[model samples]
Target: MKSGSGLKDRLVAQARAEGFVDCRICRPWDVPQVPARLEAFLRAGYHGQMEWMAERTHWRGDPAKLWPEARSVIMLAESYTPEGDPTGILAHPDRGAISVYARNKDYHDLVKKRLKRLARWLIAEAGGEVKVFVDTAPVPEKALGHAAGLGWQGKHTNLVSRDWGNWAFLGSVFSTLELPADDVEVDHCGSCRACLDACPTDAFPAPYQLDARRCISYLTIEHKGPVEEELRGKLGNRIYGCDDCLAACPWNKFAVAASDMRYAARDDLNAPVLAELAALDDAAFRAKFSGSPIKRIGRDRFVRNVLYAIGNSGLTTLVPVAQALTDDPDPTVADAARWAAEQLS
Candidate 1:
């Protein structure tokens, strides 16, 4: 039961039935250009505190090296496009704006389960060993997505599709069966700097290049301890990951609705009041964000982000909320609270 005739077509049809918006395949070694680009990004210290990215260069730079026996990389996209404009919450400084992807359940869990099911199906049909990966692995999903023709990497360094837009989550199924590969997707981002210009923190050094240290998403989620004073003010009300680049893309006009209802924005997280979020103790925060991706940052980091939002709120009423957290046990949260209190004062 090797990859016989009509197997590729059937695999794609099964993927669609499993709820993936788009599916394409590429050979494991197709992305020959990744090593140099990855080296350049790491050499420039653009990865910031994400040292794991620098550690696994051999595996991360080439999918072939990850599993030498794997033949085809099945790249799939699942859309999580928000029903309403995600950036609209930015105007309301009193509210904390969470990234569209993090507004509901964690995508890693959701996408991984789908990928596992697809991998099982592929194994049964083709009699080949299979491994599934969502985001946690060192796999270069965006590059493979481009190689597989699901989409091209846009100027913001995220995968953008003409058919499905830029709001899709990428997952891969690595298989030993030699499946036919799809045509590569060429770049369509011509002379557009909307994503670069839209960054509140000026994170993008140039088109298609991102400096994670200056990115609000990294500052809030990945970077530990107090964020640089200069950058904290630019975070605005974004308490989690930032979506300025994704929301600014004109390609989203063609974006389709997310297949799973679980990806839809939860009512509480959509535009949570900053003052209320700032008041969350450890237990309260855990209870509020149960099963959410935001919970992984823990109560301290989350509160630190909330205090920054409160400081930026300028509502004067939230000054007390920031003031109360000034003595928080977590030094980072305390520092953020003090900084936020001073901002509102």
Candidate 2:
């Protein structure tokens, strides 16, 4: 079996050929800082309704504990940078703005497939046992990515690379082989607050800290039931997830084109009309987002978000549409619809 620099070099080459933008390695226990930061965030209730985060603290805080046999972590980045300005749809309030990442196929499936293939290649070439992850588990991907020298966690608390920018999906392979670890990436945000300043709901309490309760993405995607009336207006036309902070980042200027065409925006999803999105019934919503990440939120929550967007749109033409849903079977959807109708009135 190949070992040392030769094996690591070939593994990186194989990853690039598999469509990953960058690949690096780190020791499983490299991130000593995660436990405390995670504890603080959970204590402050910043994770909001994501109780899973608190539930999996032991594993999430340390990769070494998650898999004791794993000696090295192979972290990889796959670019999904949008073709045009993702924020452009915000100008058209009558339209719903879906996050760039959710514009097409589910990234979890795409990135995981690639990670598994890479893991297979690693085992074949180096005879190492491996396990791959792509956001499904309680993995601290960003921390591992930083430790692997993929990028620094930016002020927005997302991984940001000087080479690939902030528009990438992170995946990891945990291996029993002790490959050489890379130097950690240092923070380059240095006084740049573009991400923090651009948040419509001021989700960031400070640099590198996010308050998910006030975050549009969290409200639209994770939060169950009706969002607080005070924050609903701030949601604007973003019906699925928010990207204002990501779009405003200066590092994105270096973002490479997505290697997979599946990541490209679908015309129907790019800037869908708010009224059309609000009209999605369960079957229609499932069919529309069949293979997409947006399907997980389900129709009721999705339409609830649409109603909030309709309220913020200031488009009185949508009043009837909102009124129609005021009697929706889903109480949350009904609440949102009534709120939207009142806002339009």
In order of listing, the candidates' clash counts read 0, 0
Q: What ranges in model 1 sit over 4 Å off?
A: none
The numbered model that scores best in TM-score is: 2
Q: Any runs in candidate 2 off by more than 4 Å, and if so which?
A: none
Q: For candidate 1, what is the lDDT?
A: 0.92
Error of 2 at 306 (Å): 0.4
lDDT of each: 0.92, 0.93
For candidate 2, report its TM-score.
0.99
Tens digits of per-residue lDDT, candidate 1, 112-208, equal: 9999998888878778898899989999999999999999999999999999889999999999999989999999999998999999989988888
> TM-score, each model?
0.98, 0.99
What digit string (tens of lDDT, one per residue) describes model 2 on residues 102-202? 99999999999999999998888878799999999989999999999999999999999999899999999999999988999999999999999999999
Alpha-carbon deviation at 83 in model 2, angstroms? 0.6
lDDT of 1 at 315: 84
